[model samples]
Target: MSLTKEQTQHLYHKLLDMKKELSGEKKETESMTEEVGELSNGVDNHMADHGTLVTDRMTDQTVREIDRELLEEVNHALQKMKDGTYGVCEKTGQDIPYERLKAVPYARMTVEAQADMEDELETDAPSFEREFHEQVKDLSNKETVDQKSSQTYEILDREQDSK
Candidate 1:
């Protein structure tokens, strides 16, 4: 289901507000990063100072990346609103509640759908240890099957020879 005109307008305002806020945040992040710029003064700065600078730079980088991604989501949500697809769960094609939309104007999926997507994402990455163990177990099982087949064949040959 689609949103009512009033709901659409409300969400549109909410999204625009979010866009403005995110833009400001992105600008702030940019300034923070510019101030924390390169590690070129390695020789002049004390080791602890340099370490602190590097740590701050790393933290700012992560923040910048997160803000950038959020900006993209906000932009996408705005576009969806323009395209008349807002307030509908992207995964289920059902209307999202006004409360939910108010809480997260950029939400593309319903809570249940989002949870399911997260579950799928979490399960997609197999742990290296488990994968390695499974591969080793499979190889050993194949070898065991092959050895049993050979032993069975040898027993059959001995019976034929006795006959």
Candidate 2:
């Protein structure tokens, strides 16, 4: 299925927007890395008190992961633009809806194909009970920490009263 000139232009514009967004994200990641480097050498008392090293490292990792995904999508869209298949679905020979392509220029599957793939993934994954139990276990650990902190605070208050 071939797109009209207008449709092609629309998809091209969408791809351009995605490229711009990814570039901005890449810059943000670079800035974050620089900040992390600066913090590593700093002796500021606030930095020591906040203990944000772990949080910064995790944030940098998350940003890098997102940047990688965005770069992949940008590359895929550029490839499709080169091949004149920008709006066509990889799974079906049909032309993907313009709205969908506008929303996700790198999408390889039509809506129906995407839905089918999601359904297949859902069936292949472990049962909800297993996932629920894992979540419950995580929440229980957090609750335990909260309880411990509260008890410690109560004991400290009682000691202050006695003093």
Candidate 3:
């Protein structure tokens, strides 16, 4: 079903709000150096403290990346709105459901189309990688009565024993 004028306007405002929020959040996230509150990069601190700082920095970076991606999506949605194509599924050329649009204003595909695309991506994995994943799953499901009777079980036992 096509979006009503009110629905389109509602989604447009939602996208704008999301864009503003994401942009502000991206700026507000403290940088590693700012968060340190120290004169240097923790060189004079305990190794564990330094490690924690590194981990914190990595986490902050990941958050920023996510915010950046969301901001991009919001901008794309805004552009689509300007182009008179908001609420339309890019993949299937269908009018995206109002409920889904309400939930994810920047969504470019319908839920079913998105799931199908994800399934296609899974199937598009390299044959060797898929085979390796299947092998791992199969091994995980199999059991051996005795470690000595199964080479896989023996190796796993050895690794566990060493650990």
Measured by lDDT, the strongest candidate is 3
- The 0-to-1 C-alpha lDDT of every candidate, in the order given, reads 0.70, 0.68, 0.76
User: Model 2 clash pairs?
Assistant: none
Model 2: per-residue Cα lDDT at residue 135 = 38
Worst 10 residues of 3 by lDDT: 138-147
Which candidate number would show the highest TM-score if scored against the true structure?
3
lDDT score for residue 22 of model 1: 63
Q: Give the TM-scores of the predictions, in the order they appear.
A: 0.63, 0.59, 0.68
Candidate 1 lDDT tens digits, 64-123: 665667679889989988887877898989888878888878888999998898677557
Q: How many backbone clashes does candidate 1 have?
A: 0
Worst 10-residue lDDT window for candidate 2 reads 133-142
The lowest-lDDT stretch of 10 consecutive residues in candidate 1 is 133-142
lDDT string, candidate 3, 50-152, tens digits? 5787876765676576677778999999999899988888998999999999988899999999989867866999976765544443343436433355544
Model 2 misses residue 89 by how many Å? 1.4
In candidate 1, which residue pairs clash?
none
User: How should the candidates be ordered by TM-score, best one leading?
Assistant: 3, 1, 2
